[model samples]
Target: MIDVEVAVAAHATIGESPTWSASERALYWIDIKKPALHQYIPESEALRTWPLTSDVGAFAFCEDDSAIVALRHGIYHLDLSSGELDLLAPPPFDPRLFRFNEGICDRTGRFWVGVMFDPVAPAPAHQKGHLHSFTFQGGLRCEDDIAELHNGMAISEDGKQFFLSHSREGIIYRFDFDSALGGLGGRKDFAQIPTGIGLPDGAAIDREGCYWCALHGAGRLRRYTPDGNVDREIKLPVSKPTMCAFGGEDLDEMYVTSAAEGIDIAEEPLAGALLRFRPGVKGIARSCNTGAVAKMARVAKRRID
Candidate 1:
């Protein structure tokens, strides 16, 4: 398998999300603190960036030539070509109290996103956040009361398990999932970030059923087997790797994102750069949980009323 950690761009202030667009043959990522979006084309070594007006937590691809972006203030449809944002859903929660965090599109074309207590408020440890599932057809469904900070979300290959991370707690949990209805069940511990090392940031799994988690502040990624044992560790140059996604022509590469928000760039030069390396096993590509879509004719607004 091809393997190497290559610094792909100037460090983003807070690089949090890395997504591969199979259609564009490129990678799309975000700089949370900078509040920007980026597209990196490997073919021509081209990079394009668009600045956003809000602190975008996460986004996922859509068939409508746009991305469903969960912004600081609301959910919007971001025009891929023009970078214009049209409101899809207004602030479902109080913007002053919360903002979007890590989220993705599930195999059924339904979107799962979570929120975190406003970072500037009192310690997030005791604060309550939430994870929500949204469908163009069903509108939006709140899955559960997540922790103060949420990250690391992905579904298992069989569509029966849901993986989520409570970063503040350094714990990644696996839950029973109802793929047909997009419901979450009881959660069990999948892994925990070792003390004094790093917090679990974002995570992904490979064809081998191994879980790959970005351990923020540790400068490394950890691969956990199905049994929740550490199988491998991929180290990096910087100390704050935030997220990782599988992309590339064969989907064999793992692209990682990092944060430079609280670091001294001079001491850690590659802190905010996008990095990629190939893992032997291919990754499970994300899907748009369209099963929920086919059930509804039009997106009738509900909740958030």
Candidate 2:
């Protein structure tokens, strides 16, 4: 495996955006601290970015080339072609205490997201974060609520397992998943971040079933087997590697995002930025957006019979 390279310089404060768009053949990410949405086309080396009206935590592509974004306040529909934003749903639970963190679409097109206590909000005496799964037919359904500091999330290729990480606790959990029933069962420990290493952040799985994760504070990206064994490690030049995904025509290129959250302004100038590398492993195909449009069609067809 090759070492990682800085694709984008440290132009933002905290970068947490990471999503793969198959149709556009591009990787879309957000600079959460900078509060912007960015798209990168690796083949042409073309980069496009747009300023957002609020702090966007994560986003997924819609069928019509638009996007569904999870902001600090709620979920919104964003027109990728024009950059227009429209509200979709309010926050699932207590709006004042929580904000959207990490999210991904499962194979069945359900959007799964995590909510945590807002860093800017006052710390409650006993606050616990939550994980939620949103289907097109049903609204937001609670999956789990055990994380202290919710972070990275991923699902298995067969849609039978789900992985979730708690950055603060430095542990990853695996769950038995049932997509049709919209429920998670039999949670167990998956991985644990050793102290002084980096906290686990965003993650992706390759076609071979290895889990690749960004080590948020340790300046490294690691690949692990399903049993939680470390398979490989790639050190980064920048600290705070936030997230990563595999893309490119052949799905060999690994894209990463970094953050500048806790670094001194002078120590590492380019703290929050985008990075890329070739790790020689193929990634699984990304799931399609099952937003309102696709979900409605399925319902209408079923009703006609």
Candidate 3:
């Protein structure tokens, strides 16, 4: 087992994830239940947060430096400089009963977002959950019908394979991806979380192609080979670790986020905080979104009309 240590204590409730921003050399994440966006710069020991009107599930930065966020109400573009929120367009179907969850950008720069029923509520029939791809021109296209809860997402270094998680089912699926068509096929089970550990949430792939996953209720982060063999476990100080990513100049440091909401009183200190550790594993190179945001904008305009 690899020893994991806490780097920072954010004390955020429902801390969702950490995304490496190569351009800024910083880490970005969110506090879903708290409805805030956070950015942490390791070198400068700088941490900043912006409050949002709605829960922010996930987001990716556009080439123009604005952030596109998946929120409970709909999608919107957030200008980090001016703190402006520009509503794009709502999801194609009714989102009143569902909300966005885990999401990331594809190699082509399109933002791929997933939606799931709020855990506090009973599952809705019309809401089977879905994976949607958003381009600046296309708005939001339902890409695939997913399980009731879709979480962690990772793309292979070659961009030929896509990994998605069914958090509640504790299973991860691998699909062959076609970059040209923005489609997926040949779905196969990739990994299954060992019973009793915890359900899987967000994940990141290292340069070795090994997947490192955050175990939501387990208070641990685990690494597994591509074939699903458990390799290492990094225990966390928080009981509700939500997601992780490799950041810092060398990409050798792992930054994790946790949630303070819904935990037993004993685990309260671990809730709603950001944590980090150095695992000495180099991460895969960060990929950029080519023109996906532009395409999504066009799609949003058409959908609005």
Candidate 4:
């Protein structure tokens, strides 16, 4: 495998989500602790940041050039130009105890976001986080409450499966999903990282149905085939790669985000830097969440009870 190298000069405190925009040929990601949204242009070598007051968990582009972002207290449309946020839906969690963590949109354009209990340490005996699906028809409702440290959340290219990873539990579960019928079927094991490799953080799916996950403390990216076999693994210079996205003109390159929240400065000098490498596989483009697309997707959205 080709060696991965630094993609940007940034050193985010806790870089999390990485979203690709083929139209703009730019990658959008966020830093949780810094509470900022980033727009990175590869061609011009420009990395612009939009400082946010609250920790924005995740976001997707809108038809009107704004962004649907999941903030600490609620979901809102972020005006990219003015950085103003319009409230859409309030969060289901107690704003004082929990916050949104990771999220992804389905093929039908419905956004699925997961929350986590703040200060994972001293966690309670019961799970407090939930996975929520936001759609034009269903609005925002809890889909699953089994997650604690909700991390990786990805929808399959076929739109037939929903994958969610619980970092604290060290398990990734696959759920049968059918938006047309408002379906969310039983979940089964997708993959489990070994106890020592570090917990799974964020993930992406390739065109071939392989799941690629970032191991936070293991310093590696792992690829699992549809059958749950380890198909590929690549080591990285940083120990806490938060998430990754496939981008570029051909979508052949993989861009990864890392964290510098807590680490030995000397040992992990490049801990929070953005890294990229050729993964030799293409990824399905993310679905747009706006206007006609969002309206059409309502037909496929499954309403939660």
Clash counts per candidate, in order, are 10, 1, 22, 2
lDDT of 3 by residue, 103-199 (tens): 8888777788888777445544644677888777666788875776788798889988888898878898889986667888888988898788799
Worst 10 residues of 4 by lDDT: 296-305
| Stretches of candidate 1 exceeding 4 Å from the true structure | 1-3, 120-126, 288-305
TM-score to native of every candidate shown: 0.91, 0.90, 0.91, 0.91
**Model 1: how far residue 151 lies from native, Å:** 0.6
* Model 1 TM-score, all chains together: 0.91
Least lDDT summed over 10 consecutive residues: which range in candidate 1?
Answer: 292-301
Q: Which of 1 and 2 is ahead in TM-score?
A: 1
Candidate 3: worst-modelled 10 consecutive residues by lDDT: 286-295
Question: What TM value does model 4 have?
Answer: 0.91
Residue 45, candidate 3: Cα error in Å is: 1.5
Q: What is the lDDT of candidate 4?
A: 0.81
Candidate 2 lDDT trough over 10 residues, lowest sum = 296-305
Which parts of model 3 are misplaced by more than 4 Å? 1-3, 119-127, 264-267, 288-305
- State, as a TM-score between 0 and 1, how close model 2 is to the true structure: 0.90
Candidate 2 clashing pairs?
17-30
Candidate 3 C-alpha RMSD relative to the actual structure: 2.5
